[model samples]
Target: MHLQEWLQLLCSHTGLKGSESEDLWSLLPSLPSFSLSTSSLLGLGALASLTAYWLVTRPRPMHPPCDLQAQSVAINGDPNCRRSALLKDENLLEFYYDDIRTAYDMFQRGVKITGNGPCLGFRKPGQPYEWISYTEVAQKAQWLGCGLIAKGCQLNTQQFIGIFAQNRPEWIITEVACYTYSMVLVPLYDTLGMEAMVHITNLAEMTVVICDREERATSLLENKEKGLTPKISCLVLFTDFSQAFAERAGKCEVEVLKLEQILDLGRQNLKDPVPPQPQDLAVVCFTSGTTGKPKGAMITHGNIASNASSVIKILEGSFTFQQGDVSISYLPLAHMFERMIQLSLFTFGARVGFYQGDITLLMDDMKTLKPTFFPVVPRILNRIYDKILGSVTSPFGRALLHFAVRRKQAELRSGIMRNNSLWDKLVFNKIQASLGGNLRFALTASAPISSTVLSFLRATLGCLIFEGYGQTECTGGCTFSLPGDASTGHVGAPLPCAMVRLEDIPDMNYFAKNRQGEICVRGPSVFKGYLKDPEKTAEALDSDGWLHTGDVGQWLPNGTLRIIDRKKNIFKLSQGEYIAPEKIENIYVRSVPVFQVFVHGDSLQSYLIGIVVPDREVFVDWAKEQGFVGSYQELCQNPDVKNAVLEDMRAVGKEAGLKSFEQVKDLYLHPDMFSVANGLLTPTLKSRRTDIQKVFQQQLSSMYNKTAS
Candidate 1:
């Protein structure tokens, strides 16, 4: 009963009004369940008074006075990095951002406020480079949109346009032009060869393609004549505006326009450009298919805008990015990853420099540009690591590098210095200046990075190396490393706008309960399924909106994700034990002497076999020490050398916690490393297991026969 009701009953039963009752008795409830002694009642009153005082005067536990205070600008609901409730149970890290829907929307707002500052930087032959302001970029897009409309290009009617070129200022112009007219962009990578380009153009049914050079235009024309891409109706050349350009256009029997001509045409007919709807198809990015034909992923404007905003918010939470911050662009803009970075840079009006076709000149470009931000791939980072350490051959030099690293680590651990002055001056500064004196951070992606390499770069260079993991269908890195992420070999966490979950895969024994399964994702960042291939779409995406990323993943102890292997790559042995060959390969390849390892074992085989490619430099030194010096090919033919490397491989497997059955019994040394040109490696530097198996079938068979004998 309530206190007031109980008091009334007591007054009626005792024949005493409340006014006549003793004031001390008021402390106790008058209900039959309350039988408080006088002393007990006094104690209860004192406890109540203490609690009231504490509630009124005590400091709030959540907002205690501290030296470091959070700075947040509230956008939408919350602008700070927040715990995403969708992945809260899984403990995935993510950030919340301003609610923005399309790339055009963000660019429109940011450009108006930032004004006509430098937005893009490009190099010219035998002359000084030039920078295009945000005003020019937008104005050029408007003109291009007008020209496209004048050429009978349909807006928002799913007109696919192709960009058959490398990174350039014109590429950005073409992209914004396409977006302004609601044309779906189909970016063709230069590395994808002419045949892949023709096939993609055919599949995409491109109305017009923009080419930066004459060579690609000639190939596209030849392919068009050969009926590879019959739907291609026009070619707009950015350069080469001579009679030959017109001749090529006429010879191909297609309407051709120079980029300048298009811009002028648009200038004559310029009007207010149509703004893109949120649900409009932004781009159709094709996957680099290692197994078969590529599939086009239909990514929408919402997808790009949402992902860009999330990453922007993430960068803001970690560090500061101001207007005119320089970013080096060297990776293929045709790839969605680079394109996403380019699109995201608009939010801060960051100045981006386009790298010339030559990779050898990247360092020069970096030194000249003094880029503050760089998104590099693993192969590049690995190359940088080797080039710096390659000269540390003397024992004294190696010991010094080691000692300095240890000292720096110790000083940081003991709080002696916030930034280790000794390492910074003697070691890191030179390395940092080599890339660019102004580099604040760098990103690594495209393939799995060795944690050893990742850790060494951070330790020796004293810079933050954030690693990201994603696929084309997932709009590039759905998960990126956070500021405080210390773990190696893990993708940081899903983007804040995305919801990720682990789904069970029973055949290979992957389970969500074990925090290991096929990674399934659902969010604004996810694509709108494959274009023109509903069957493939149905297989990849389900009714529940989860896109089944064929990759198998495990959550680290701290909730970061480690990609274990492709689901289809796992194989079983005759002994009925499942073996993940990729996992074994990942560990075994980390050995300094081992360059590339492709672990192979059939369902009928008892033990795994490895095709090992030894690091040639290390192999030569070891060979010289053994007094068996010869060419690399001669050393691979030697059984003793092969056995010695095989023994080292076995030790590596054991250290990685592989079972005895999973250990490589024998190895055949490959004379050369796998490369994309060899058809054994993907463009992203991933080994194509099926291709490798085909190439080494005879060698593997001989190894197994020798083992059996």
Candidate 2:
């Protein structure tokens, strides 16, 4: 019998028959044939509505679809030469500051805007930071400039003032003094070595050398005695000097004056400032030479100002600098990257606290200052990540930490970043407090950071951390990641002052048509040219004003740049395959057992080799796990330990999709780290490839001989 008829009869016999039941039976008969009952149909309708609501309210992607897939616009129908996808009219973004054309002008604007606000900061090892007001800084700068003039230093851009010091208030003061007086400032650091220092001083013909310590002044006098830098006529010491040093300076025919003396001279002489024009050379920044002599990059007032202004505009919506904002300065001022950062901070009237000249004390400085902004490199961030993860020893603690990270990452994906969530309050608050408990933004640059570390820190810190890419030639910034970008490996679109393009690197098999080639930058930020090296300048800057960066880059569909290889760092193997040691090193360094790695490839060989400095603690832990115990140095020589590390590296390389030729076929585990102190690393922590190779020549040859046997 039909179900509808059966239901109707059953209702009638049971004395349950009514108009409502009859209508229900009629509706069931008219309903489309289905096994689902009326209740099931109602449940399905509710589920569909919920699904529709979810579809509409779900979190959108961080970047637009076009940004994720579209190619940058090619210039003049040449796919090889492209600008950012955001540009349609092909015009670069204008400068953020309309009137500020020079760093001196920017500083003056800051003095007017922030007035008596804290400008520079200093502190003892254990004390809170002390601040210098903007007005005081301006006054000091003027006095110093006048003093320099009174000391017979020329009052024009031709006069080069050499500053040999770490990051300190005195260092910045000297810089501003140079800027305001139109004197060229040349920074000297320990990493430059005596030879490079002598080279730089003589090349620039510096008459005055301002140093923070007595030792620096003595060193200059000694160099004068050796007749290496004879043009150095005045020694200005920021610290108190001894009578013996004064005598030494007198014998060297150099006038010795204390910083206070210079200030007093300036106070008596009081001259008006001679601020430079836009095109005037602001600084002669020398690159940290890893293989050859350092080349001084002649950065103009407009080059640096425009770069800073462009960065400010790009980051204004996300990281607006305020008078109340404070930054810790630990990175070397000699490096263009840090100098550019400080310049931007000064432009916005922010406070900068100098670290205690020791990297180990950086966190203590941060804790005392409670800095609002942090500019860092991957090495430091990696250390922080390792320390934080290592501290959670308990299984429950690890689980909870992982859970919190996952939850926060989900929120990040949903376009919500919070420092007040339940997970944050319970788990990540402590982590945030370790970094001064007040960090609102941070930046990582100079090297690529792992996505795992980046994501973890983004969730734990509950603030924005941007990655930037540039060289000294471009005034330290070419491109920077957007504020909320969650992706990794790509340094974001070009800054407003930078017009970036890609050219075919045919030798490296990189083609711009394939969205891969050498990165070329054009715009106001490009340097005036390498100081005194026209041939080098011509090679760097093409006829069309594109500065060809030696970095090999692949353009992402999102119009972002991913630095893939170093065109100059590539070497051919016996099999005719090109191997980029830096590219392979970047991957193998991700192994937990590896702390620092350098991959080496010889043209005569068919395979690559590596010299790895393992993370001491982790390596020891693994050794103990394997029931072997020894001192770190002894274990480094153990064959078993060597094989284990090699295997771990292999696993990491495989996971990273490294080709067989790219993977290290043999490994040498070194106990000593490649450090700047050892002359194996540069001031920026980049490996001095030639120096490292020289240091490990014996090991390298032994490994190759063994492989051949």
Top lDDT prediction, candidate number: 2
Q: Which lDDT values do the candidates have, in the order given?
A: 0.73, 0.84
Report the poorest 10 consecutive residues by lDDT, candidate 2.
Answer: 62-71
Error of 1 at 4 (Å): 59
Reference-based lDDT, residue 112, model 2: 88
Model 2 deviation from native, Cα RMSD in Å: 9.6
Q: What is the lDDT of residue 592 in candidate 2?
A: 85
Q: Per-residue CA lDDT of candidate 2, range 1-709, in tens? A: 4445545554554454354345446656466654546776567546635544554444443433125344256668776566555455677654577888899988888898899999999999778889899999999999999999998988888889999988899999999999989999999888788898888999999989999999877777888999998888898989999998898888878989999999999999998899999899999999889868899999999898888887776666445888888889998898899888888888888889999888888888888999999999999999899888888989999999999999989888665666778888999888888889889889889887888999999988988788899999999988877755677778887776777888888877888779888899998899988889899899899898999988988877666788888887889999999988888888887888799999998999999998999987677877787777898998999988888889889999899999888998888999988888899888888999999999999999999999999
Candidate 1 lDDT score relative to the true structure: 0.73
The weakest ten consecutive residues by lDDT in model 1 span 64-73
Question: Model 1, residue 454: what's the lDDT?
Answer: 82
Model 2, position 133: C-alpha lDDT score: 93
- Count clashes in each candidate, considering only residues at least 3 apart in sequence or on different chains: 0, 0
What TM-score, over all chains together, does every model reach? Answer: 0.81, 0.89
Write down the TM-score for model 1.
0.81
